[model samples]
Target: MFISVVIPTYNRKPILEKCLKALEKQEFNDDIIRNYEVVLVDDGSTDGTLEWLEKNKEKFTHVSCFSQNHLGPAAARNLGVTKANGDIIIFIDSDLVVTETFLQCHADALIKGEKKLGSDRLFTYGAVINTCNFDDPTSEPYKITDFSAAYFATGNVAIARKWLEKAGLFDTRFQLYGWEDLELGVRLKQLDLKLIKCPEAVGYHWHPPFNLGQIPNLIDKEIQRGRMGVLFYEKHPTFEVRLMIQMTLLHRILWGILSLGGILNERTLAPILQWLINQGKPQLALEIARIFLNWYNVQGVYSAYRDMVKN
Candidate 1:
């Protein structure tokens, strides 16, 4: 079976090169690799990324490069999927390095029927290994799982093309970052599709510390996260059982209060708080407000009271 590897990249040229080299070393049979195609979606990077891809196109015959305007990673991935010609689709971030057995392990799982879910085939599974140190003797490898709300790490997973078609692709409305994966995972669960945690299918994620100047962007991320929280609760109200989902709005409120107290590191909380406050309490809005304020043992009584009056 052909495996389509979709890699979404921004301006990280060095990291992208590392991931490509690892792909070149897959231990899977030559026939599989020959059948497999690597689709690189460049999300309108200004770092000469397109030129680089053009220059290196000869290195891999199966590598297909595509470019689009400055859309987010989620949109870029959807574009890649449209161009893919494989039965199974594997998504690996441009910042990760895979083991030689990466493809082989996931393929084996599917073929042997070792992992599945309900009446649907088990298509999606996690494969990221995030560690503090890459070479430290004491640093052990980490595997991604859905044991908790924070389980689905980034885009280092594989899924069947049919599954993507059935469950829908990544939500493009999540313009920039955060919560898109969680939203997808939630949808998969609702569809009764199992997302297994395959430790043997491993890859190392190289995440560097953000620079101080990137704080604004980080805050913008949190704001987008808060917005996603709003959408998430609207879609899956049952997600209240998940701590991350439960605390979604409250987390923003807490951060705002903490910022006011001069104890928080992020500065974008104030704007986010102001935005949420302006969203006026509909019934669901009032519920979220009460939940947000109640988490801090604050008086949500007035907001609830106001909501009742308005309604």
Candidate 2:
């Protein structure tokens, strides 16, 4: 079966070139390569990426390039899908180094699966061999049986074209980052398409060293996080579940205030607190106030007040 590898990249030309080179070394021979195509969706890269693609276009036979406005990766990927000619789609981040068997494994799995409705193939999800060396390999891949829209690794995932068409594309409402994959995975499950965790189909993720520039604008990022939280609650509404989420946000807020006062060093606390405040949920705000003895709650209130001033 032909598989189209869709790589959505933005301004990371050097790494993207390496990614393409890795695909060139796949275990699948020229016949498979001829059958397959690499769709590089350049999402409005300003880093001479167009020139780079022009320079290397001849190096790979089936390489095709598409350009669009900087509408983030989700939109870029949706565009790539529309242009793809293969029966199956393998999505690998531009930062990853794919193994020779990567594309072959996904194709083989679908070929091996039992017959299903509409399409005879199943959706295959795989884990990235994280170069950060942080993930616990001992953890088994578990079935996602909840409405939380839980998904396995996003770095290396494959899906049949029909399944994607049925499940619908990633929600562009998510805009740039976070939770779109999980939301789509939920929709796929709801459509009764089986999602299997293929642990063997591995790729190396060269996680870049931490840089502050990679961080989004603090308030804007928190607002997006709050928006995701609100969307999740809207999708799966339950008093207990909502309470738990609010409490988690409250804890993060309290911890953040404490850390700012030199009482703690939990780095994520501040952003978490900021997100809760941005949520603007009255009940959540009241809960935050009640749990932290009014003092820290007042601090959060004042912090938010200061943020508005800065804006």
Candidate 3:
């Protein structure tokens, strides 16, 4: 099958160049795979991603660029899928630098899964290793925190285009920050689609090292994720959805105690977090910051749920 590696990018030109380069170097020539195209949908980036792509057009031989207003990733991905010319759709983020055999691994796994399951009702989920090493993202080793139990995430996953269309693409109303991908996963689950883990299709997800400077944006993202999570629950309205959104009493109490009832917030924990950063432990600092971050999410989820109830 022809493959489309669809990536929805925001203002991430530097890593995006790396992402495209890696995809261009893929070694995919299996019987199940024909050829691949990189469908890059820019979500109205201010960082001149399009211009950079134009300048380095010769570098990326397999990329087809598209753009839309800053309508968030859901809309961007929808546009990418619509414009794609492949039967197999591989969803990955622009910051994820993949290995040369990434596509091959996914293709092999898909074929094996179909044969074993007696049907093509399956998708392949790849491993995502988070890293702060921009110079060589793939050099970073996997950590426990990188272990995700998510059934489906847009980070590194491949599925047939027909399944996505049948399940209905992401809800554009999740215009905030998160849960658009997993919401679609829920629908795919209802269609009896199984997830086959493909660990060989590794992608290193790169982000900047944690610092006090990033606290505001990070917190804002959690809140936005919470709001969008409420939209996810509204669409499904199941106990599992509530648990996933952290909208339940257990999550509320857990985060409340962990954050010391919201008193251990960014301002109060600044010294500790800064100390951890100064000690060259940004990862630990980020983990500590998650205390208040999770509190904000639980609060935001409940607040949105309350607003929905009132309306």
TM-score per candidate, in order? 0.73, 0.68, 0.99
| lDDT of the candidates, in the order given | 0.64, 0.62, 0.95
All predictions: root-mean-square deviation over Cα? 9.7, 9.9, 0.8
The residue-by-residue lDDT of candidate 2 on 113-200, one tens digit each, is 5443346645777656544222322132322321123353357788878878887887776674445666666677777777666666
lDDT of 2 at 306: 44
lDDT of 1: 0.64
Tens-digit lDDT track for model 3 on 1-311? 89999999999999998999999888856566788899999999998999999999999989999999999999999999999999999999999999999999999999999999999999999999999999999999989999999998999999999999999898899899999999999999999999999999999999999999999999999999999999999999999999999999999899999989999999999999999999999999999999999999999998898899999
Candidate 1 has a TM-score of 0.73
Better of 1 and 2 by TM-score: 1
Candidate 2 ranges beyond 4 A from true positions: 29-34, 115-121, 132-153, 211-223, 235-311
lDDT by residue (226-253, candidate 1, tens digit) is 5555555556656452345434456446
Ranking the candidates on TM-score from highest down gives: 3, 1, 2
Task: Report the alpha-carbon TM-score of model 3 versus the true structure.
Answer: 0.99
Model 2, 304: alpha-carbon shift in Å? 13
Regarding lDDT, does 2 or 3 come out ahead?
A: 3
